[model samples]
Target: MKPAEAYILNQPEPFKSMLMHLQILIEGTFPDVDLQFKWKIPFYYLNDKPFCYLNPSKKKGYVDVVFWVSAHLTKYNEYLISENRKVVKSLRYFKLEDINEEILLTVLDEAHQLKDKGFYKRS
Candidate 1:
């Protein structure tokens, strides 16, 4: 298995299940994305550019879905949780059932579209 897949499988209990579900959603949402293991986490890239990453924050008791260019995603502020971060923003999930699928999908889709359209390059 790839290191990224292994990382998700190694997670314990509910976190493992949550990561698996999230992996499915991400793959389904961006079928062309490339999954790579970097900085000990799963990072997804689009057309060779950083897009998003997944982390099961065991210490924080939540999973973080981090968007690389979140600062530009002000229109979706209600769905983000950066917590004083400068560039990236994230959505946190404490439980599998707590995931807002529709919002998450929308945010991910927007992020992908933004990067694809060269929004990051314009900055």
Candidate 2:
């Protein structure tokens, strides 16, 4: 397990379970995507560039998938945009059981396409 994964597992209760679920869902959707710890949180990267981060705030009681490199997403994906500057451009907020599999897969597919087109920096 990655340091990030272990960290998530160490979290208590809802956070641990929710974090693990999100990680599994994302990993399942993009089995080839790379992941690491960034800013003390789980960050998912495509081709080494910033793709998205999983925010599991135990205090705030929410989890969001944040895409900082939102510049690569077209208007077609604007529906996922977040107005909060603290968050990445394309943000998807979800509760413990609210994860939409299809939407997640679509976003993963888009990220992969962007990575393949050399839209991201390589590690």
Candidate 3:
């Protein structure tokens, strides 16, 4: 298995389940995305550019679906968490049930479009 897939499979309960579900949703939505192990997490890339990552914070009791070029995202801002960081935003979930499939899908679609337009190239 790839390191990215192994990372998800190795996570403990709740986190493990959440990551798996997220993995399915992301991969299902973007069949062309590349799943790589980066920064010790599962990072998804579209057209060789960073798209988003799955970060299961066991200590924090939540998984974050982090988007790379969040500054350009215009939709679903209410669902994203910045945590004072710049250039990135994330949809956080404490449990599988906490995931809103519609919101996640829409945010992902928006992010995907941004990537297609080379938004990641901007400062």
> Which is the leading candidate under lDDT?
3
List the global CA lDDT of all models: 0.86, 0.72, 0.91
Clashes by residue pair, model 2: none
For each predicted model, how many residue pairs clash, with residues at least 3 apart or on different chains?
0, 0, 0
* C-alpha TM-score for every candidate: 0.91, 0.80, 0.94
Candidate 3's error at 9, in angstroms? 0.5
RMSD of each: 2.3, 2.5, 2.1
lDDT of 3 by residue, 64-116 (tens): 99999888888999989999988899999999999999999999999888865
C-alpha RMSD between model 1 and the true structure: 2.3
Where does model 1 exceed 4 Å of error?
Answer: 119-123
Q: Against the true structure, candidate 1 has what lDDT? A: 0.86
lDDT of 2 by residue, 8-93 (tens): 98888777777788788788878767789989999987766777888876776767777765666664475575665654564444
| Candidate 3 pairs with clashing backbones | none
